[model samples]
Target: MQKRAFTLIELLVVIAIIAILAAILFPVFAQAREKARQTSCLSNQKQIGLGVMQYVQDYDETYPTAYYYKNNTATVNGGSAGGYVHMSVLINPYLKNAQVWVCPSDALRGVGPDNPACADWTNITQIGCEAQVPRLSYIPNSSIMPRKRGPQDAPNVVSMAAVDAPADVIAIGEMTDFSNCIFLGSTGQQNNERRNKSHRPVNAIMRTAGGGQWAGQSVADVTGPIFAITQAAAQGAEGWGGPADTRAITNTAGCRGSAADGGLHIRFMSPGRHSGGSNYMFADGHAKWHRFNDTINPNRFLWGRTYFPSGQPVLDQAGVQVR
Candidate 1:
């Protein structure tokens, strides 16, 4: 019976060992979890890319229009309205999973009164009128079209074709808010509450034709310059102006200024923060982590100069061509 006695020192040693192990293994576990999430996000982007490719095959060679206006009121130069298509909807059939509409890392999902959780995507629908269309969380390169006033403005229309392989062209990128689709230069301009929260100064970079003062005087408004054409075009879309959807990442440090509205922003699959890296699926159908600043070239990132009145460039992480 006396052999069963245990000393306090023995118990303390055991507890110390456990504490040490926990300190060592906790980070490893956390890293592993993040890695898994990142992989899943990449897969989602690849599937969406495939969906875009499928849509292209079904249609002539053109990609889905990033966002279509419903009525004639929102027309820049008397273009037809309605039938606006966002990359999210275009690829919905291809991804075969509506959940891909949201990024796993976005913290804004289901956060504030305005924030909808990633799971609530079931209720998420494209917003806009026939003439004035809304913005989507994602945009496709195939959807990028010439900004000419013509018959291309129709419902479910595929305007632009992928100039390069599916892997070379960007399929989807982060959209500011659904309201960003509204024309920034017109009376339809609606101030987005998220704008104040966005890391980028939406009002400063948005550039209203009336020359109104930028909204919100917070010093935290540190959005980068609106670079790249495609990003600028996507951002220029009536609804493309707004704050970053933090729900996608769900964390503050990973938050970035919303991509320039118009058609230049590329929506890629991202899950959690990758140490300032996001997941993107190239036209070649491969997923990789693109450092936010890794622009090896500049031409690949430009877009929408001839279409929109503003000829801005959407620069990539490394200042490469992301138009």
Candidate 2:
């Protein structure tokens, strides 16, 4: 038999076919991987919702405070500051697994300037992660939980019974580098980050304290808003159509206009950009995924009982990676 070799054009054609197949399959594979991560995140949220519900049952149906100081009256930077505690810590007993607080797709890992990876949880004890106090992948609804720093302000709590539509109200949502636990107040004074897109809680104040010191005193004593409050994205009462929100979301934030901070502004960044939407835990402890814009749909707004728009979403303002 005579030896034969494949023609160059034939080989090229085969290679081209392989390349085309790869191009088509790669995105599908990527989406599959992303779907897996989102599923894992949703599982975490489901457990979290159950844990919160169990916690509520034990605590007389009152939602846990996002955070509270052992010494609320402690002066800022005062040495006598009492170590603070977060909602995650309060519900750990119900969860039985500290890692449940983390989402598999968490890109920023945890809040704070340290930028610890998701695997690097706090170890000083009583904190959420191996290295941080409130390191978490989920954010509680501030409207129900209330955003209280170390101050004399009375605890503004919403009980399970107080919610008119428990199923429709959001109990918890995924956290992103740009997410504020306070929900979508992405306009004017409604902005949690009067500055830009950043974790409203993990600000300068959190940078001032260590994980151990935090376990011993309220973070507010040394910080401004270490307790992150939810979306605080570009939505308001009109359900994403709010005038200020429309201005913020319709255009690529910074490209169309300028924010007070002088950075690229984007009114809304999808919290669940992993899958076009993010996972949420409802007040009833049921968890599921939802589209970001859909969460604020005029006919079906789910952030809370009402909406308010404020803040300009500064894309560059977020100090960490969300993807």
Candidate 3:
């Protein structure tokens, strides 16, 4: 027998075949990977839901305050009397793993714990710790809490027993890198600080009209770089005393706007992290995914006045719950 090697033509044919196979299989493989990430993200949310339920059980059926406020402040954990404590601190103890707070597909993974961009639930030093916001991937439903910017003396705590439709109302879900709606420090003020300064007030475009902050405003009219707008607009319209009346998308990709001096706007929007919807933990401790439009369209009735525990038609200017 004589030693033989592949001829150039034959080698070229094999390489070409491989190239064709790679071209065909690469997308399939990418899709598979994404699907896995979505599943993992769902699992993370489910765990968080369980954690919240556990906390509620231990805390006399009362939902944990969206964030632990320092003194009387709401600017995140270390701003002053109103600093916000990370919500993760209140729920993570039940999860027993800080990683549950992160989504596998997170794009801005911070340098802290787990190599995933999420809050450092394992080592919570204080409210403004540099490592906290980067790790938070989810935010709580603020509609359940008293308005953060409203009167400090208002009753702000939302008890789990108070949620009207526990199965339908959202308890927790994927949030944009930055948010202006109610939630704890993880998705609100503190989270905003770690993002690009040019992107200040990141999720403003999702504003809807109604609440005193953005009364009579529409999501369509608000446009432009978020930072260019005034702090109020940048913060998005908040329903100071009740459920935000406007609607918005889950993620903040194309969002833009500045606050109107005294216009009403809706600021709460869901994050569509998966195929076309986002994973959510319902108030009843069930975790599921919902379509993007399901949350955006008021007609669908996923996120809105119905979700609020207060049965009142409107919140007082002080943001007090009128039952």
- Candidate number of the best TM-score: 2
Against the hidden reference, what TM-scores do the models get?
A: 0.54, 0.62, 0.61
Q: Can you write out model 2's per-residue Cα lDDT over 167-285, one digit (the tens) per residue?
A: 88677776544433213333422223432222222111112112111111232432332211123333322112122212234433322232333211122232444566778888889
- The parts of candidate 2 lying over 4 Å away from their true place are 73-81, 112-134, 178-270, 306-323
| Model 3 Cα shift for residue 255 (angstroms) | 4.0
Ranking of predictions according to TM-score:
2, 3, 1
Per-residue lDDT of candidate 1, residues 213-323 (tens digit):
222122221133333322222222222232222223222222233332332223222211454555655444456676533422244432221112122333444444344
Residue 20 of model 3, lDDT score: 100
Instruction: Give each model's clash number.
Output: 86, 30, 30
What's the lDDT for residue 239 in model 3? 23
Worst 10 residues of 1 by lDDT: 196-205
lDDT of each: 0.37, 0.48, 0.47
- What stretches of model 1 exceed 4 Å from their correct place? 73-85, 110-166, 174-272, 296-323
Return the number of clashes found in candidate 3: 30
